[model samples]
Target: MEKFKTLGGSEGSTFFFSVERQKKWERLDGPIGAFVRVMPWRHFGRKNLGYLFAILHGADFFFDFDDDNYIKVDESTGKPVEILPSTTVLDNVMVAMSGPTAFNHHPMMKPSIPAPSWARGFPWEYIKDEATEGEPAFSQSIPFVSKLNSIGVIHEGATNVLVPKHAYSPYNAQASIHTQPALWATLLPTTVPGRVSDIWRSYFAQCIFADSNLRLVFSPPKIEQIRNDHDILADFAAENDLYTKSGKLIDFLSSWDSEHLHFPQRVEQLWIDLYERSYIELDDVVALQKWLEALITMGYKFPELKPRFRNVALMGQFNFADFPNSMTQIMMWSQKMRERFQTTIAAAPLNKTQLAYLETHRIDAIPARDLKLRKRDHLGFYNPLSNLMRTLLRFENSSTIEAVLYAHDDALLNLTELSEGKYPFPTDKIANRIKGELSNAAFVDLRTMPDRAKARTLSHRVFPNGTISDIDKTIFVNTSSELKKQIPSLHAKYKQWGHYYCAPGQQQMAMDPEFAMYLDPDGSAWFPFHTQSDFLIVPTKYAKPFTEAATMHLKHFIWIECAFGKIVDILQQQLQAPTRLVKLCTGFGDRRGRWDVINNHDCQSESVAVFHPFKIRGRFDEFWAHADEINFPAYSSRGKN
Candidate 1:
């Protein structure tokens, strides 16, 4: 990108470095209007925010690298370069690659050494020349026109490098630097695997460079690969696309007739092809759209994004969304829903005026009575979730939703990595990852972490039979046998057994929903599973069965917790897929007994989390503010990747 004007003064002598957190920081204006807000909690795209940080701060040169790869120390002085060198040209000389547009610098070995090892994402086609364990003749690549902000090249950089306007070797988040001209490519892709996001960006940027005046440079070895422990097999799995599709991507780029397209259009089209081929998700393209806009706002100019294909059809249709599915739009929708719920019946469903206010916001909700739930006072089921099974069924019929994260508005969710030191946060990606896990799982019970004991204790509710006293003391309905005995003259299909009838000193009623459910039809007793009704995740395939089970239980006026939990149990026996119960959140049920403690609760002291039972907005806000007090650690892109 051509520099327009400097935001600050000239470069200073003091080295200024700052570690950025990877979460939304409320309103972001100017250049750093990062895609963080739209990014799914903590996807790899969040790291792209760092690029804006570098730009907003008026950085002339940007250093990008993984945390594990540290600068090499001078053995004699025991220092990592007493003085950081400005020049990257090694031995005051440079030699450009003549054969291939890629280079792999294994710092530990000289170029001439025949040990021959392939870099993490070197094309497999080249590596698998079985006759020669790891050697393949490469031909000249077509030239690209890009400016070069040369510091020479980073020799022995221990990463693959791309020849400008030609071919590429995967330059990773492991060790790399970008000058102003190359800074535009530093935004890592969001939708690809965290392990391969950088590699994905590398090929993309190199392709752009091939058409710009930008140039790649060389420098002496400065950093060593002190990588952290990684399961090689897992790394391979994560990089499956990189291994298999790199060559295919190259072929696509070579034949892509987009020479007339602008920079952003080219970038978008490249990702579009990848998405169309099932190489990446549409989420990445949307993110790229926002990223380019941010670059424009920052006053940096690229070739331009206007394309001939905007109005014209190419393959019978335009795949790109006319209005991109941006993060701001999503946030607005969520805010609207929350506001509607607050007025509609969430805080309290007592007033029609409030309900009318909710209708103005376009929040879709059916009345509780329509689902056969009581309007006088909501109870039992995860408050108001008697509709959960129905909603899941709807999603199943629509086939749009792949996974569901059913949670109480009160539960605090720490889906991101930095859920304060106090809140116990999740360890890995949840949304997309859970969607993937759905292939093997019928549903995953992601109840809050603190609710595990509650889930276990309530998994199976027992009814040791009951007497007349149990009628008023606990909920009960008469057995079918008793109903026939008590009210025979009534309607033929109508039977309550005998309005919760019981014998003196003789066991009669089956007290809990679990026991009641067993006698609904057959005489045999059936056991059902129980879990906190607060949170759950059900994939679309099993939604119908789950909803049917829950609806049946609810129809008999069983408690909500029983209706919600037993559906999972019913599915376990009815289907082959296992119903998994995983601790995916931070809070469980409300601690009404601990009201005194909660009044002064220090949310920062709780493990990072998305807790529930924050039914009151003011209380949730206070706790959320406390939860935000714990600082986020530095953002690292390569660790999880």
Candidate 2:
């Protein structure tokens, strides 16, 4: 607002943008003539012009704020209050927040009170934890993302120094900065509802910031808004777009895999996709197109939109018959992965009809053997999983495939966990996460790990008798003769330390150190890998090595989970770097952890990148109801759709 007001006699830059001076913007006969009517009368959408105003006036950076938000004055002292420091320096003491989808800073803005209102454009789906007293649903994890005070409220409070954490933080035109590089986010969609136009702009711009590693900091409220008269109901009505579509918007951005786009290009593609879904207007996208063109015409170079092309092979059993719902699930994932990667569904060719269908849908089918595990013992699941890894590791273009996402056949990955793609399985962003963080050993969920590594289980109560052996007699009793012959050395270790094998409740960090030493009497740095492998990802380069080393004449398996852990453990010794892992989804290491995913699905839906044990075969309707917030699976199968 101050930037525009200062363009008084600066005709050189003023020719392009001259908003009415201290006068009614609604007047058609104002200085800019009927052009004022082109952008709607008395609408918040006009705020986009502020960004244009900044760009035209040679401002490398400009503060984009609203008129209703006033500079907060300290009654005790007649001066501007310092809400944030005016410096950018780094040290161990300095906190850091890297690439939060949305920074819910309102709670930080007013710590004492429960900042319950939603950010103007925050997704309603995530805000499921409602205060039973007729309050709006709020996302439990990202509570502050939606706080209602930004709307016509008289704010009063001091804020704490910012805390560093990843979240969905939406800064508004209310009082936000738009530097030269950040200018692309200031676009206010002309056709957006008056109430949500600014919000739409915020999400649009934040996508670029979040992905590009742009710095977006928060501070105390430097302004007090004494908003003009407004019909509260009308404002609510205008927010319909915000309530329904924000989740999809953020979800799309979060899982956007385009494998080959960056910055404004990705931003443009997002708007295009949203427009196709009728979630947003295309004219707004064009406005952005023109803005970029104008900047380019004036010889203003945009920082290059670096290409983020990542190709990945999704290796898993994609059965559609035993699990009819698997058809729709596979289709959904293939479509989702295409958003972020050049994807290949490397499924076992066991089902010819299924392979034909996948190929017909252009879901580039890659033949990978899904050898079945005949035995039900500790090492039973090793053969088929190892066979699959060996196949994926030897991809035609293994160098091109960045990572392999392995999961249960029923796992449905998406955002917000709503139906209609309100929340689906995650793809692009998660693949990048797997690639960036995973080193030679394998990825693990380090967050839930103890500060110091020791033998532990989900519940400390599930300890075994002091010195027991062959406690897991199943190692020999259920072990098939074929598995024993293939990995006799591994068989010995499995039988020897079978007591320490992890179960639903009896998972060990690495099992007891004595047990570790027992397994590898001659090995050093014998890191016991966690057997939490209902769903997992392995870097493509390590997939073959991991599979090859799974039965390292040592460290056999308890289940497929144990195989995954042991593979990483065996291979880590040969790699140059240590391992790093992340817990992409919520549900993990619980009592009914494998059996009851739906019961806890409500709580774990939003936070995870890859959801597991979704069991679409039986829970199809249930997953749909949970995801789309609908009655059931709208289409019986992908064919029906």
Candidate 3:
């Protein structure tokens, strides 16, 4: 490429360096830009007068072991130097200096750009000769700059020579310094072949001259037939692969695909080829914008056609809206409505039935009856609004995206309305009853409230013992150890199957929109009289009465507590042990509890299971004392849960 002026300064002025002479008189040209040099101190000994010699003359830019032949001395003088030939030394020096400040430096690494703004028109200058020996092999016909500043090339009597920042490596400066002329000669084309070379040179010239933020774009080849217009350009770029800055320009132009072949696969292939060749990896948003722009520029036809190209190019950010998916759009719209209603309904005083009516009709309706007229109530399946909301919260906190929520506004609004209201719905009454009963327990109340305003009330409801709902799976420390330690083993052994019927604590149950786990403290049939036990009594008006009593009675219990992954895996491995599985029922109907009965007799006295409920608390050490008491190994849910 030509040596073109990018900004208004010396050509490649952004990169330049200086070197200073040292006490040893062993000098070499240093590199420009950020680089480090490893040198020995003893080379600049005081008596050799080498230090004094450095004071007068500047360094020879080429100071590798190949040329100087300076070996380490033993007479209390200097350190050993590795010997190398001049050719090796010559190959490494990038910029060199003989005497004075006259230094030779290589050409700047430039980026390939389509239209550079630095020089007025075709700003690149090329060299005629390709060789590097004897005199400067080539020179840019254009004058790059009037004067360039040189720093640190000649030292002021220091023990060690110091090259200026941004100078080439000390060993390679000599060779690099002499290459600028050759690059310039190659850039200035002379023959038909040179004319083709000129095209690439011009392209690079433009790139180097453009402002920092701007990038060039090139036309892609047709999918069916690749063009042979710039074979020479490819050869030049391929040979000079080390110029990273210029590689950027070479890639942008090559990514475009021609319109000749109308196949989708063909178009994709063309785009991929360009992407692979380009050095720059664009961000998703930037890529999307670029692809969009390219489509528009190409004048894409057919509604079905444009999106296919856009999606193929975008890779990640192609939205469903771009593809005209109505169902997905509708779902998104409904979810948004659900969220809006859920948030606003907290402050609105409306019953579930009333809210449901308003959501479905776009307006609420209330029926009236006269004294003479009597009508039967509407028989219908209750809408599981609260349950759905709880699930939504869990899903939102876990994996559900905001976009999906926003889209499902309508459905969400209807569900939220069905959940929040003044009139007593079956779910609302059932939830209240469960809370009232659990309040008699000694457990602390821990409710999963939608907001902080209801926490105290919810806590008061699950009195005596805390009501831990499925929603508290993460927050509540309801492990088996805590369960056995807090309440008696008799109660823990037969976990209230009915508790799952109403929402545990105040959180909505997910198992069946209508049921949850709420623990009852004063659960025994015998308890004090004349106490405030009337309100603390179980209210089953909302659910069907269980006519049949529990047939499975607990004789002995064992509890195992462990970390999620380890203990769970061990339990699975031991599943085949000879034991009848005991079906567990929570107050709610989640049905996840099933005990492994290692041994049991048919209503016999001596029948004892290897595993049964055992309390765990304080620290893990406390459980070891009871280890001998256990018939077999036991893990506790106290810590693991």
- The most accurate candidate by lDDT is 2
lDDT of 1 by residue, 1-641 (tens): 22322322226644322233332332454334445465564566555666665675566556676768778788998989522234432233222222132334332224554655656666777553222121211222212222233221232342223232334556677656676666778877777788888877877776665445344543445787777999999988989988788877766654343544567777777778778877678887777777777777767656322111111100000011113322112222223222111111122222354334333333233334343444323443332445455555555654223544554434434333322221112212112112122223213332222444333222212234532212112223333344234334322322321232112101222444444544423232232332345555566577666666665555455544334444665565457545443332233345541223332333333332333344323242243233222211122211121
Model 3: per-residue Cα lDDT over 20-139, one tens digit each: 323111322221000011222332211112211211122122121112222334355454422221222212211111110111111111224432212111112211111110111111
The residue-by-residue lDDT of candidate 2 on 160-266, one tens digit each, is: 22222113445566776555565655667777776777777666655554334343444446788898888999988888878777777776655454443444566
The true-versus-predicted C-alpha distance at residue 613 of model 2, in Å, is 33
Q: Where does candidate 3 stray beyond 4 Å?
A: 1-641
Identify the superior model by TM-score, candidate 2 or candidate 3: 2
Per-model TM values vs. the true structure? 0.39, 0.45, 0.15
Error of 3 at 565 (Å): 27
Ranking by TM-score: 2, 1, 3
Of the candidates numbered 1 and 2, which has the greater lDDT value? 2
* Cα error of candidate 3 at position 197, Å: 23
Better model by TM-score: candidate 1 vs candidate 2:
2
| lDDT against true structure, model 1 | 0.43
